[model samples]
Target: MTQNPPIRRALLPATALLAALALAGCSGGGSVRVAAPVTTGSTAEQCAALKAALPATLQGRKLRDTTPESANTAAWGNPAITLRCGVGTAAVLDPHSPAYDLNADIEESGGVCWVSEQTAGGGFRFTTVRQQATVELTLPAAYAGGQSPVGLLAGAVLKADPVVRDRPFACV
Candidate 1:
């Protein structure tokens, strides 16, 4: 065995530290920054549960830790698909508003209900209309094909939060 010189040993530690710091950051997909979501205590608590339930990877992409990270939000992939919780639910599922997404498009699977739609720019926007807290998901246009993150998140929400289904007369 050969012993390294004194200078070489000191340089090795510095090199290792830099490598470790680099790995702690968001992957090459890039770190997506957004304002920290605002929520009431009850909603924050629900979001906390959802945050804990989020997987390290979704749609086969590594999770990206957002700037000003919070329990109310989550992200995955290079372009970064983000999920925001504690949103307000609709009073009624509308059919005419530009932001309106039909309940008819909602799909329930793995104990979670999802309403997903493609935007004009070709990206996808999805939201949970029937869960305890409204969780909104956004996927960039670059990632047009992949397994949906809906089921994975649904499982997590089911475990951490309450199941909520739309009612005929209740708020959407």
Candidate 2:
């Protein structure tokens, strides 16, 4: 029976480890997983416009593809900052809800009103308030400490689905 020399055996394990790491890196760069929002009629049209208006890069992160692609979804970066248009208004926005706190929770950026919520994973989710159709943006925990990127999305939201004058909420 033939046996590998000590040096050859050592190199074999090192080579295997390098190959595994390379594969992992490649997988990480693949498409981001995002649940596309469902839109209909006018809302669908609005989302399409918003998708087109979304910046090619967000917070210095270049845009990346999303799985099961749809016109209402977009993503960027390895940790993935994701956006979904034409979503239903967040339940927390309701005045009657116990979690509602207009003064404390609402934030205004680029003339748009937003409400932010911390996710279980320590990330943050910001959603537009009082717009024709809600748009949600999520930032991974890696972004928890930096300046908010909600402002970066304001232009596209305003251009595609400006706030509805009749809606109850407004950025003050």
Clashing pairs in 2: none
Residue range 72-160, candidate 2, lDDT tens digits: 89999878999888887765786677866655477899989988888889999898987887899998999999989999889999999
Error of 1 at 72 (Å): 0.7
lDDT computed for candidate 2: 0.86
| Residue 95 CA displacement from its true place in model 2, Å | 5.2
Candidate 2, superposed: residue stretches over 4 Å from native: 1-27, 95-104
Runs in model 1 with CA error above 4 Å?
1-30, 90-98, 101-104, 165-172
Task: Say which candidate scores most in TM-score.
Answer: 2
Let me know the TM-score candidate 2 reaches against the reference structure.
0.81
lDDT of 2 at 72: 89
lDDT of 1 at 62: 83
Compared with the true structure, all predictions reach lDDT values of 0.73, 0.86
The root-mean-square deviation over C-alpha atoms between each candidate and the true structure, in angstroms, is 5.4, 4.7
What's the C-alpha lDDT at position 47 in model 1? 90
Worst 10 residues of 1 by lDDT: 163-172
